[model samples]
Target chain A: MDWNAFLLSLKLAGWTVAILLPLSVFIARHLAWRRYAGKAFVEAALALPLVLPPTVLGYYLLVGLGRASPIGQLYEGIFGGPLVFTFEGLLIASIIFNLPFAVQPMQRAFENISEEIRDAAACCGMTSWRKLWRIELPLAWPGLMTAFVLTFAHTIGEFGVVLMVGGSIPGETRTAAIAIYDRVQAFDNAAAGAMSALLLVISLIAIGIANLATSRAGARRG
Target chain B: MADRPTGLDARLVQDAPIPLNARLRCEPGEVLALVGPSGGGKSTILCAIAGLRNIAEGRISCNGSVWYDSEKRINVATRLRRVGFVFQSYALFPHLSALANVMEGLGSGRNGGSERRARELLELVRLGGLETRRPSELSGGQQQRVAVARALARDPEVLLLDEPFSSVDRATRQRLHRELGHLRGRLRMPIVLVTHDLEEAVQLGDRMSILHHGQTLQEGAPHDIMARPANREVARLIDLKNIFQARIAGQRPGAGITALAWGSTRLEAGYNRRFAVGDLVDWVIPSGSVILHRRRRPSRGIRENPVHGRVESMVRLGDTVIVAVKVDAHAGYPLFMSMPVHAAERNSVAPGERVGVSLVRSDIHIMPALQPDGHDDANADP
Candidate 1:
């Protein structure tokens, strides 16, 4: 069953979401509300990973964070380990790869909050933190939930980027998707089938939950 | 510094994205209605005072507290400014219950019994039992009441209402108006209301400001502005229908008469010395001030600025009939008069019929003419 690989996959997905969700909340909010020069270009750059070949992205990550790169050397000097082919490297890769999945839904959620509602909040004497905690967070919950679920599931099922950035080290970097691929390559059909079924069910459940939340939110708003 | 500012005082000047050159003042317990046409920057003025909008150069202060000053660079954040604003759409949080929405405006920190205060506010707005219902669960009028209650929860120094009654039906608007009237008696803050409906402005405003193309042309009591607009544009804006160009023939101050040359006919008006004897001017008399002469009667009012005209159009609006008379002295100009349907029927007034009318001299207001090619005041010319 490759239990270590499956647990590692869950851990990577967890860490990726924990880091990306908070960061995406701020980024998505800024994109939704503020206007600036080159805003369209910035958005297009953020969405680049969505359409680019996973292997191409992986190659860039390899060069950008490999042992020979400055960032890779700095991390190795500080942590006594190379940046690539480690759990941390895999987590970083997962976050970057899932940027669109994590941010677009949250951006749309923030955009759905009408300008009048925000103006009313300001006029009500609510501070920035209070407005976010009391009003924005509650109203944008469904999109945030959808973002978490999609990012988690996509991170778990990723293959090309994971393989390119984190070479399949058995317990450190070999996630569930890599384990499935390894089993197929080794002619272990039974193991491959079990892992594939698990991933398929997980993805379907995630999508189903996201759809339920969005539809409920839509009905409530209606 | 001679007079301590007690309420809101603001002057805004901007050149882009809805140009504004407006200034307004309202004392405590006074309602200043900003009445203008659509796209006239009425709402923008309210937003500027509330600190929701930015003006290129301006100073806005409420109760002696400076909310925005471009020269001093002292722009206060909207949350720090104590303003209770009621938007046209209400803008209630759809996720929260009515009670929670009101509670949100109380500001965090004093937690004990804030819920009670919210409930009391709801009760004040006549939504006592519906506190737990969400905005979507309430009717449009009910939602608006909740919005008002929420705004009041801020305990603000100024209340800004932006077409608050526009979205509701006529009956609901009337009821809301009555409720607002009732509510204002207890309020001690200045209130700024923006509306395009002149009738609504006249009914609610202690003073009304007429705006056009982002400029405040005049501000005064509604009755005074309607009776005597400051200029030709204001006359047209207030729907004064009997406006015509005339030349001053003579001014007899002792007799309280200003003779105007209306084509070949000389019409007497109340003495106004603002214009010289040879000056061209524009004059207006409200429809109500144009008295229709009864058939076969030489009434004493006929001795006033009497005129002969043919009725061009007769429109019956419910109990009143509006008769547009084409004056014989001025070929293209028409004088409009309105009277009870019975009075109109008794006079046998109909289209294409000739009639005599009298323009009340005291009611005829004269203003400097606008430029021949543009809306700029003719007074600007040397």
Candidate 2:
């Protein structure tokens, strides 16, 4: 396995999560509380990538942001190159593909918080931000941790979208999921097995730790 | 403590599944028990007062400051309204310990002193040693106390309680009542307590407001309202189950007595209204106001408001004994009477035995007969 590609994969997941976590939380919180026209449409749009083939999403991004389109040309004018097959392109693809993975759990968490607690805080004269930081976030800690872990793990497993948008550019877009496929196609069964096993172990540990922490938090609430 | 504690004045209207139009007031240093049955807009009144819910019309003010004025289109947000609201569920933050829950109400203004004030409040509620426990770890009563402490930490101008004691056990409710009575003395601010329990209202309210279906039927001191409900509905709400349909026999306006025709007999009761002769009226006397005589006293000696009767049924509850007596003079319904067990023991009262029951002259109250709508005054247009 190429250590550079492995390191780049971790970096890609890290950047994708760093950008998506806060964005998803805010979006999910708004969805949980507020009602407006076209809300259902917006929600369905956000969740579409979850069920859509990653290759299809990647195909749209590849064309829509590929220098020939207005946004792509505008970006190219600034950066002197098209967005496809770039590290930045891979991050954008990963964020779109994993949007629901970051939102649904957090939204459910916020919704699950008892209205009594919210009313209590409001009546007691706490500011909205204080209520969110002091009461809501702590109580919804398990869901937040789960959302973060899932987003990170999902980004690590980017295969089709990464292939379509970031096209195996060695250090730029060769994530672990893509790297294992590359090794298999090159007829190196030993390398493919090793990469696949490593990825599986890491993903299991990430989810297991999140699950264990969530149960601990639930017990404390009891 | 505020030198001039805030009083409350509000008139709210809501046009929803059920229309509501309520007007209420409470002076500083007073507990106005807002009493009614479930779904009678008791909680709605409290919510409107605290700004937790909005009203379609009318004004809300605390002392001199107008919190909401629909005409002016000036509505203060709930966070801006200086109100301490204790919800029925005692909504304590589950993740925060008791002390921290109280401290959260102190706002960002008190950084260093919040912990001390929160501790002082917990100690006030007698939860000093258990300050570290979360709401889930505390008993229902303790959680309610914590919620109270948290609400008061803001030093609010108005206090609203939404059946704050309803969830606790009977023993805990009694303890909480005593604690609330004590708190009232120190609070000295306007309080609006929503309760479906009539006994609680009578015991704790300096003044009581009786509501039905979102409209306030009557408001006065508890005893005054109880003795003189505006209509039959108000009478029923106050647990006055012994309403008799009596007609006006004669009027002695200067003597303050309106003679009423109770089934086959005439009895004169203290009357405030100038009810004309021959006009029908409903006379009410509370069950506890009836005095049972061991034997038939002579018609001349203390015969005022006296009726010979036979005991029909008896129920003993602790120190209190409730007896139903069927009067011989009237073929009408039996009169339910409640007296102390000792009083009954002295009279040796038993079911199937004959007895004499009379009203304490001052206890007999008379009201205008029910109109078709059960309202003394004509109702609004349909």
Misplaced by over 4 Å in model 1 are A219-222, B1-4, B373-382
- Which window of 10 residues has the lowest lDDT sum in candidate 1 chain B? B373-382
| Chain B TM, per prediction | 0.95, 0.90
Among all candidates shown, the one with the greatest TM-score? 1
Per-residue alpha-carbon lDDT of candidate 1 for residues A91-198, written as tens digits (9 for 90 to 100): 888888899988999999999999899999999998888888888878998989899998999899889999999999999999999999999999999999998898
DockQ of each: 0.79, 0.68
lDDT score, candidate 2: 0.83
| TM-score for each model | 0.96, 0.90
Q: In candidate 1, residue B285 scores what lDDT?
A: 84
